[model samples]
Target: MIALVRHGETDWNAAHLMQGSSDIPLNDTGRQQARDAGDKLAAERDAGEHAWSAVVSSSAIRARETGELIAEKLGVPFIRVYPQWFEQHFGDAEGVPVEEAMRRWPNRDPEGFENDEQARLRALGALEQVAKDFDGRDVIVVAHGTIIRSALMSLTGRELGFLGNATASRLSQGAEGWTVHTFGGETLEDELGEPAAEIVAEVEPA
Candidate 1:
């Protein structure tokens, strides 16, 4: 099982700014949120509900910080950082207000911006890599909301909207492939069955 956690909120998130690859640190509230999330995970583990084997995070500062806090709380000794898990690069739209960014580049075609398909592919690849690396172990992955949402949408064909800061979404891998379940353990989707190649073919630049 892999639990995908969004990093805690930053000031730019509060301001509704585009923070794609911006390297913003968390605010005080964000730090508290990370600690609170850690506490919750610890409680779940203490109750023998789940045992987290490791905590892996994006190389971004905010995500790293969150993963560190969570790992500490869970008494997990190792934390790995993967650059492939970095948030989607918004290019010229980054660091601007969200509404203004949309108005300026409605199609996201301005130089430096990553298209949706590219972001989705990166997210998928990162998740698949992690699953392979930590086979048969439960892990926590700290990443950005957009990347998590993109991966979920591609796998489930459901637009889950923005994932809340420090919140987790659960995914599991088995012989049939990846299966996504709600945090409550309800089955949301299954039978993904190695769609990476299919996604690559479908989203190829045309």
Candidate 2:
């Protein structure tokens, strides 16, 4: 089983900032959230011991810190960096509040973000790679919310729009291929203000 986790909170996160690839750090609350997530994931590990074959994270500091904490809890060294794990590029709206920016750029597609076709391909590709790369083994990836959602949609052929924060999407490798976890949220759910506050006390079963 491969468990994918979104990174913990950050300054922009608390402020409702877009935070594209701005490289922000976690505030105290964010740190606490990561810790809680880590503990939860650790508990879900096999044999009552949270362990993983490998752990990967985005290059961003926020993601790196989150990956580090999870790796430490799982007793696995942070093993890889995936540039694809970076948050979707929000262009001029990087750190601005979503509503404020949407009002300003009502007609403009945010910068660096892929069009629907691109997002679909990227998301699916990431999911396939992550699910296949660590086939049958429990691997954890700490990434941004948008990235995870895209990947989920890609794997499941669901479509972009719903993935919540501080929540993980699980994928299992099978004879058919990579399969998406139903427990995770989608992007639009975040837009409606759902994911950011959901507390996942435990991730997998320990």
Candidate 3:
């Protein structure tokens, strides 16, 4: 089992800005949110949820801090950062408001913006790598919202929207393949849905 968690909020997140690949730090509220999320995860584990062996995170400072806080609560090791888990690169739209960017690029395909397919593939590859590194053990992966969303879509073939700050989505791997248990707190049925490849253009920030 793998628990995919979004990093806590940053100023850019609060402003509805595109923070792809940006190295923004979390605010005080964001820090508290991380701790609260950790507490919740601990409670879930105590209630017989899957036990995690380690906490891994993206290279971004915000993600690293979130993972560290969760590790402290779970009494697990905080593994090194993985650049492969970095958020999708937004190109010229990185710091712009999501609405403004959508207006400028109706299809959300801005110049130099990383395409959804690439992000999805990158996310899948990262998941495989992480699973390999911690073979036979469940782990927590703290990453940005966009990449996490991409992974969920690719794994479950469902149309998922934005993931909330510090929220977790769970996945389990079996002999057949990866199975999505929940997405952004919504429990999913075991049946797989049709693949929804297109990322919603008018959607809000990742």
Highest-scoring model, TM-score: 3
Candidate 2, residues 1-206, lDDT tens digits: the string is 67778888887887888887799997877777777777777777755543467788888888888888877876777888777677777777887897798898787486665555555455555655666667667788888887777665555444445444556666566665555544453333444344432222211111
Backbone-clash count (model 2): 11
Give one digit per residue, the lDDT tens place, for model 3 in 1-206: 89999999899999999999989999988898899989988888888888888999999999999999999988889988999899999988989999999898888787788998888878888888887898879899999999998887776556677688999998877666677777766565422254333222211112
Q: Cα deviation in Å at residue 138, candidate 2?
A: 1.3
User: Which pairs clash in the backbone of model 1?
Assistant: none
Model 3 ranges with Cα > 4 A deviation? 189-206
lDDT of 2: 0.68
Q: Name the candidate, 1 or 3, with the larger TM-score value.
A: 3
When 1 and 2 are scored with TM-score, the better candidate is 1
Of candidates 3 and 1, the better by lDDT = 3
Q: lDDT of all the models against the reference? A: 0.81, 0.68, 0.84
